[model samples]
Target chain A: MLYLDLTLQGLIQGSMYALIAVGLTLVYGLLRILHVAHAGLFTLGAYIAVTVTNAAGSLLLAALVAVPLVGLAGMAIYRLLYEPILHRPPFVALIASIGLFICMEEGFRLVFGPYGNSFDLSPVEGSVQLGALSLQTVEAATIVAAFGLLGALAVFAGRTRIGVAWRATVTDPEMAQSFGIDTVKVRYLNFFIGSALAAVAGVLVALLNNFVEPTMGSVPSYKMLAIIVLGGLGNVKGTLVASLALGVMESFGTIYAGHIMDRDAIAFLFLVAVLMVRPQGLFGKA
Target chain B: MGAYELSLLTLIGINVLLALSLNLITGFCGQISLGHAAFYGVGAYTAAMLTKAGIGFAPALVAGAAGAALLGLIVGIASLRVRADFLAITTMGVGFLFLGVVRQQEWLGGELGISQISESGLGETGFLLLVLGLAAGVFAISLYIKRSWMGFAFDSIADDEDTARTVGIDVARYKLVAFALGTAIAGVAGGLYAHYARIIVPDAFGFTVSISILAMVVVGGIGSTVGVLIAAVLLTLMPELFRFINDYKLLLYGGLLLLTMRFSPAGLAGLARLGWTAGRKAERRPA
Candidate 1:
């Protein structure tokens, strides 16, 4: 029963990881640049959601407002900060992203204060029990929402013209451009969708943890770096699989080796192990 | 100089060492490490613990550097297969792991950290001179390396590893050497920082510090020792100079980084070079 409970909890957390990791992977696929500032976008989404939820008294309204705002912020960041350096070495964009990350994190600190904000939404008052296992309402919501978002994304990417354009751009931007597709617009759309996914994960995380802090996104962002690498860089399906695996490993690691190995250390050690053992990742194609 | 000014100068010296160290790896070797602070922390803790155990300062510093170099070798080897963004993330993870270990281990002083690190007995003036002398020594070494065959190998690897390898340059060995040398310097800086501050906390060497050091290198002009030195001094003092806008200092720093990368990818040194060349061209035209 305890094991089953842990599995359920792991899946819930893993779902959030999948959402965040997929966003990172998508951006990496579209642009060779790793958006370190994506974490800032995640934090912004959470803070904005918190502010909106507190003011308007509706979680749905908060998501509707904050997600788009964060998405626009992502697009704006690309245009203002990234577009000029797109042709430069990847490191230049990376350093710029790091700088943007610092600005956004510090900005959040100055605006929201350096403390955690309680997620003002009331808790869903019940839990569902199945056989010997029980799941909290928020956990269920997180799992459902994560899968729903990912499924919607998979379908959109598979069925739609924009999705085909996106995949084409990912495959080869110059080739896609030669095909009359606006690679630049595709990149912007990619950023928007990725940022939106991160925003949803951010809000879901706040709901699960019941608090949002300025630095809340930092650790997860680093962990998601590990996840993306574990899933073989820009592989979407691999990212989802790696996220769940990491979630489960973390759950069990916290249970058994929590005293010896710090929970954070476990994730990193797993990352190192993966890098050492299978540099291409488990599900990644060579 | 006043105590405040002397301490600030000492800090700049330490930061210069750190920036130069990172410049060696990232700027010169073309390997990005987001965990440079982990080496710094390792050096600090090693020196602090050894000195706390009554070891001599010289030996403690060496141990700190050696310890960091060892960790650097391990990380370098582990991340050998990865490149660019993958390498950056790997090093970043290593940094987090270092902090996590420090926070969890009571022997390393855990969250409370180690304090009352016995002074170097060199006081502020003497310590400043010591740090300055060491910084100059490291600067000379960097210049030598920059002009040597090793520099050529690093440059080739940075430009294109496969090509370098095809040309018979042992990319792996040189990369490990760069990692070891850079991390060793970072460890020395950390040791100096620990002794000077008389207290060491794991939090002091987190990702922010790593980013700050990287910022110093990039803003200074990657691979230029003198540029790194000047940039280090400028960034370290900028916060103090602009105390009125203290809250927005990081934001300003970030903005400066973005602007610098966009306009002058080579940093201040690059800008200076460009101006020099343009002035020469104008003078020749007039002639």
Candidate 2:
């Protein structure tokens, strides 16, 4: 029963990881850029959602406000920062993304204070009793929302015209543009959807923890890098699978090795091991 | 000079070394390290532990460099098998792992850090001179490498690994050497920092420090030794002169980085050369 509970909890945690890592992977797939500032969107989503919830006393309203706000901000970042520097070396874009992330983090510290904020009313306090097991409302909601949204993403990318166009752009932007694909709009849409997904993940994790802090994105920033690499960089399904697998492994590993090494250490060891054994990534082409 | 001035000058020297070390990795080898502070931290901690346990300063510093180099070589061998960018992400992971281990362990002094560290027998002036000498030595070595056959191999690898490999360069071996040499220098700087500050904390060697060092290299112009030195000195002095800049240093540097990457990917050195060429063109065209 305890193992089942842990597994269930790990799945919930995995869903959240999927939510964040998917956004990161999407950006990397489109542009070779690491999109390090994607972590900023995660932090922003949490802060805005919690702040809105605290003020309006409505979780629905918080989600409504947070998701689109950060989504547009992500689009703006693409247009303002990344668009002009696209011609430079790949490292230029990378360093710029990192710089932007630093700015966002420090800005959050200055504006939001160094300390963290807590939800005045959280729906995640109690646990639901399932047959011989228990699950928190936050956990069930997280799994449902994350997987359901991911499913929608899969369908959108696989079935819809815009989805096909986005994938086409990812593969060969010049050819897609020559075919009159309106690649710029596709890029904006890609960023909007990706950033919205990150916002959703941020809010869900904030609900689960009942706290939103400035530096909350730091660990996830690098941890998701490990996920993207493990799933094989620029692969969405791989990221999702990798995130869930790592989540389960971490949950179980924590019980046994919590005193020895932390979760980040475990994840990085996985990254190093993967790099050693399969540098092309676990799912990447040989 | 007053004691404060002397200490600041000494720090400038140490930071110059750190920046140069990163310049070798990111600027020359084109293997970006977002976690360089990991090597520096390892060096610092090893030197701190050894000197605290009655080892001499010189020996402890050497031990620190050796420790960083060994770990760096290992990291290189593991990550350099794939794309160059893999090294970047791997190094970052290493940095976080280093911090996580330090923060959790009771033996490593955890968060509060180790204080009242034993100082080198060198007087303040003597220590400053030693640091300056080391910086000059590294600087000289950097110039020599710029003119060597191995340097040509590194430049080729930096430009395009596939092309370099096709041209018969041992890309992997050269990368390992760069990692080993760059990290060894970082270790020496870390040891010097530990003894100079007379205390060491885990946070002192976190991501921010790595970013600052990268900023020095990039803003100084990547792969430009003299430009990096000038940028390092200017950046190190900026915060000290304007007291408020200390609090906002990361924000300002972050902004500077964005601007630098956008306006001049070649950094200060490139901009200077551009201006020089422009001036020469204008002079030649005059009536």
Candidate 3:
């Protein structure tokens, strides 16, 4: 029963990881570049959501506003900084992303100060009775929200022309462009979608943690990277499975863990160990 | 040497070693390591704790380099196959895990870090000059590496890992060596820093320092040794130029990065090329 409870909690938390991982995986798959600033963008979303929710007293509305705003911010960043360096060496993009990450974080620090903000997003207060073990209402809601968003994403990708175009762009951008697909448009859409997903994850994390700090997204973002790699880089189902397993392992590891062996270090050790043993991750096709 | 001046030069020398070490890894090798600072922290914390436990500074420096090298070796083995963009993220994990260890482990001094690190042999000024001279030697070594066959191998690996492997190069071996050596240099920097600063703080060697070092490489130029040296000197001195912005120092630093990325991808090195090339072109095809 304890194991089950831990598993449930981990899976719920893992859902947030899955969302962020998917966005990251999509960006990497499409651009063949890692967006280091994605974490900063994630933190930015949480800050914006927290302020909006506190002022307007509407978490739902705040999500609506903050998500798109982050997406637009993502687009603007690409337009302003990345597009010019698109054809340069891979490190150019990496450096630019690092610059963007610093800009976002330092900009936030300048505005919000370096201290962690105790954000009061009204969390779901009730608990769901699940046979022998009871789960918090927020946890149940988290699972539903995660699966629902993922399901919606899958449906959108499968049933829509835009999604098909995105898939084509990922496979071969040059070929897709030659065939009359607007590669720029697809890239823009991917940026927006990826950024918005990161934003949603950020807001959810703030609610779960009950605190929002300038560096809040750093650790979680790293964990999500592990998840994406553990799952196949571009495989959605693989990412979902990997995230759930990682979440449970991490949670149990934390609760029963020794002082010297932190949950994070152990998790990363597992990641590094696994990667060493299996260079391509468990679910990775590559 | 004046106390303040000596301290500033010592810090500058240490930072030069760090930024140059990272240039070897990121600039020369074409890998972006977000956790480069972790190696520095590992070195500092290791040296401080070891010396506090009665080991001399020289031995402590070796231990620091060895410890950081071991950590880098492990991280390199795990993620060298990934390379570049993915490597950045994984190295970040490795870096954070290093910090997590420092924060959680009791032996590492946890949050307080290791204080009262012994300053044996040379006093403050002697130590400063010794370290700075040692750093100059390392800089000379970097220049040698930059012009050698091994340097070409590193550059080849950086340019295209798979291609380098196909051309009979042991990509992993080169990368591991570069990673280990880069980290060892960081360790040396940490050792010097611990002695001079007289206190080892975990926060000082966090991601921010990693970014600053990378900025030194980027806002300077990727492969230009002199550019890196100039950039490091200028950035270290830039804060001294403005007193009012000290409170928002990091914020201004961030803005500097944004401006550098947008306007000058090649950094100060790029500016010189811009003028030189434009002048040459004018000479050839003037109306």
Off by over 4 Å in 2: A123-125
Find the 10 residues in a row with the least total lDDT in model 1 chain A.
Answer: A118-127
Candidate 1 versus the native: TM-score?
Answer: 0.96
Question: Candidate 2 on A209-249: residue-level lDDT in tens?
Answer: 99988889878887888889888888999999999998988
Which ranges of candidate 3 are over 4 A from the true structure?
A: A116-124, B75-80, B162-173, B280-287
Model 2 agreement with the true structure over B132-179: per-residue lDDT tens digits: 999989998988897899888889988988899998999999999999
TM-score of each: 0.96, 0.96, 0.92
Clashing pairs in 3: none
* Docking quality band of candidate 2, CAPRI definitions: medium
Model 2, total clashes: 0
What is the DockQ score of candidate 2, to 2 decimals?
A: 0.60
Question: How high is the CA lDDT of each candidate model?
Answer: 0.88, 0.88, 0.80
lDDT of 3 by residue, A135-219 (tens): 7776676778778888998898888999888889988989999989999999889889888988988888777776788878767
Best by DockQ: 1
**Could you tell me the lDDT of residue B243 within candidate 3?**
70
